[model samples]
Target: MDLIDTHQHLILRDHLGYAWTDTLPALQGDFTPADYARLSHGKGVIGTVFMETGVDDADYQAEARLIAGLVGKGGMLGQIASCRPELDAGFDDWLAECKILSVAGFRRLLHVVPDEMSQPEGFRRNIRKIGAAGYTYDMVFHARQLGLAEALARACPDQPLVLDHCGNPDVAGQGFDAWYRGMQAMAALPHVWLKFSGITVNCAPGTASVALLQPYADAMLALFGPERMIWGGDWPVVNLGVGLPDWIDMSRALLAGLSADEQALIGHQNARKVYRLPA
Candidate 1:
């Protein structure tokens, strides 16, 4: 399959000014274009979209400029850049300014923010503005944030929302009921799409098994159906458990019985359409 990685991250932090890169050695350090080339080697990966890492706000433009540099860097096909949705006064202006890039979406990293942030009128208002501008919002939430997901989905009925890592499923605990309820709530909103990726790394370090995630996978396939489903390698991030090839292989294994069109949407179609990448 000709794949487009709709959710990959880059790390080119300089001078410790990038705090998130310095926090964890496993996840930190530089993953230059050369590293991504090797990681994506021989995977039939046609392109990729760079996702934002949760770092200090000072690095937003610095990181964005680096992502902009990726268009000529090869392998990068698109970008889902960063934004502070809660910062409303100038958000519309920021959105107006950001459309110049190859960015297909925006994310605020709800998991790290305070619970009250999403509850305010200004935050919800800015979310509507983001949707109004036709950019997908990568809902990076925890299992417990499903309610927030539901709220956001309802608030921005027209926005195309992609729920990252299946709400980062309770892989370590293999908790399904809570996720099941959360997913059901979000799936009821026609605009939401769920990403099936990053399971192995999210599970307990030594105990991730493909079969263990079946229920979650099955729920996603059943709830969102294939058209609303998209695959992501999570790339170097997935390297925390198995490497990129294994992640792709395991993903294919899980979707083995599905029809070809369904497979295409998960592997290529949905991501391509969502990110609006070049053919």
Candidate 2:
């Protein structure tokens, strides 16, 4: 089946600054669309949505514009640009800019910031505006911050919230029970959807196998159902673990028991619905 990768990250170190990549030697170099197309070739990947690479704050808009220029190439469908909902000033104008670029949605790396960063009323209010402007908000927080994520989702009932990386489960630490409970709570929120990506990174090095990831995958599939679960390659970051092809193979194995239509829903159909992609 053709796949629409909803959480691909592209880094252009020449044009933008990524202070976060300094410590991680694996992600230090540029990962451009051309590179992505080459790696994803013949992998059944037909489209992709660029997930912002957490560039230094000064380069956020530049990062968006850079991706905008490459959208039609490499099957890049659109982007989930970096945003700061905590600051209300110029947010609407920024949204307008994103609309012009045909951005699919927005994301803020909540995991790197303070737990209380999103607690302010203004943050929730701005998130509601993201939905009103016809954009989805991707929630990227650690497994421990699931409750905070759920609270944000509840506060903005009308906004569509995507929980990236299956709530960033702590697979390496074998933190399943707590992750499970947190996921169950997130699943209870109708507006929250889960992105089946990045679990491999959370696994112990060289130990990311379908066998190791099955339970977490099953919980996500059962809790969110096919309609609310979206697939993503997580690309270069995924390279930190089992890599793209292995992850894809593992994903297929996990969904082998499901009907073809059900598999397709998680693979591509739900992405279209959640990101408002063109038919």
Candidate 3:
């Protein structure tokens, strides 16, 4: 079966001011839908889900409008537009607008925030908004912040939470004890899911081997199993290491040991179910 990439991103960098936007010069330029199209042909990229770019906060609706317009015409596929769960005032109204546009979900930058941010009553309250609206939450946090993901999952109660990049394991040649333990804890929470994406590009060069990543993937598959897992390219951001095809190759190599059904779930079915994309 053809694969579906669940967590690609398309945004103008200057527009996002992503904390690490300039981490690599290769990603400085726009990675638009046209770019995705060029790389996806013959790659089994049957569909995709565009994650938030952390761009201009004021343009949430504008971004939603842009995403819906593009995907409506099949520029890419589905999208998870940006929303700051930390903000107050008119958030409900903003969320209502997004719902009208059919955005997939929401996200907040947890790694950059203080550790205490996750415990904050206000932040938790904001997170609950997604559950209230019946949306998923994309959590971008470090290994240390995995504890925060646990807390966030408990706080939301109903929202389906996804941890990006496998807790961004310190896979740069370091042991993955911390990330594994974290995934185990988070996976126990039935409402949350794990996103298999971005870590390779996010990690430092030559830090981890495919062998190391296997354990992390295994732990998640054992816990959440394939049904709760999803695929993501982390695109342009993935530009830091190998490009899309290489990431897909790495994904296949790592998943080679799994059953066909499990492989189907991780590569496409799980993403479709969680993100509510068209089949």
Candidate 4:
């Protein structure tokens, strides 16, 4: 399969500041592009977009500059940078810097932050600016928080939004019932897209099985369809559960019934168009 991994992480322990890694001992080391290349060597990754690893607040610009410089490295296509949208007055200046970098979009880790963080007036205001600037923003929300994500997307209908991790559904604990409903509600909006990433981390130990994932995968395809769907490796993070190759194999299994063209869309084509990558 020809893949374009839209959510890979290149963790630089010394060069970059990842405050979040200190809490999670498993992800404390470096995951450079070379390491990723070796692991996914034969997985057929044709391109990739480097995702931010939740660096310290003060390191946002430095991290963006570092990741932005990695555009042509390995198979990297662009950077999905970190940003503080709630900084009402300073956000404009921050966004101006984003415009100057080689960025395809921006992502703030909403799942880990306070729920009210995304609901404030300042956050919404900045999201509007991102849309007006013609950049797509990625929403990383848990299943229970899907309502907040839906509201955020609805508040800015013009902004192109991508819901990361299949709404980050609780495939391990609650099954797919609640996530399915939330997904249906969000997919009703025309500007939304669903990213099929991060499924491994949330699934039960033995239940990363095809049987458990296939149903949820089918629902996403049925609701969002190929045109609004995209795939990502969610690397090093994928290391928390399954490795890159295993996840890719499982993704292929879950998407077995999809046509060749549909597979292409989920794997790379849709990502190319959404991220505006080179042909």
* TM-score leader: 2
Candidate 1 stretches greater than 4 Å from native: 15-17, 21-23
Model 2 C-alpha lDDT per residue in residues 1-279, reported as the tens digit of each score: 668999899888779898887888888788877788778888888789999888899999989988899887767889999888989888888998998786999999999999999999999999999999999999999999889998888899999999999899888899999999999999999999999899899998999988888888888888989889999999899998988888888889887777999999988999999999877
Instruction: Give candidate 1's TM-score.
Output: 0.94
lDDT of 1 by residue, 1-279 (tens): 556777787666662255754545577667676887887788777777788766478777566666776764577877888888888666787788678777778888888778778878788788777777878888888888889878877877877889998777787786788888888898889988988877787788767656876677788899999899888777667778776788777787788778987888888899878777777
**Candidate 4: which stretches are off by over 4 Å?**
none
Indicate the worst ten consecutive residues by lDDT in candidate 2: 28-37
* TM-score against native, each model: 0.94, 0.98, 0.91, 0.97
Query: For residues 1-279, what per-residue lDDT tens digits would candidate 4 score against the true structure?
Result: 578999988788788788777777678779899899898888878999988878888887789898887888788989898888977767788788887787899888899989999998779879988978878899999999999999999898899999998998897786588999999999999999999999889987656778877888889999999889999999888877787889999998998898999999999999998888877
Name the 10 consecutive residues with the lowest summed lDDT in model 1. 15-24
Residue-pair clashes per candidate? 0, 0, 2, 0
Per-residue alpha-carbon lDDT of candidate 3 for residues 123-193, written as tens digits (9 for 90 to 100)? 78888887778777888888877888888888787877888886787767464777788888888888888
Which of the two candidates, 2 or 3, achieves a greater TM-score against the reference?
Answer: 2
Which runs in model 2 stand beyond 4 Å of their true positions? none
Question: What shift in Å separates residue 40 of candidate 4 from its native position after superposition?
Answer: 1.2
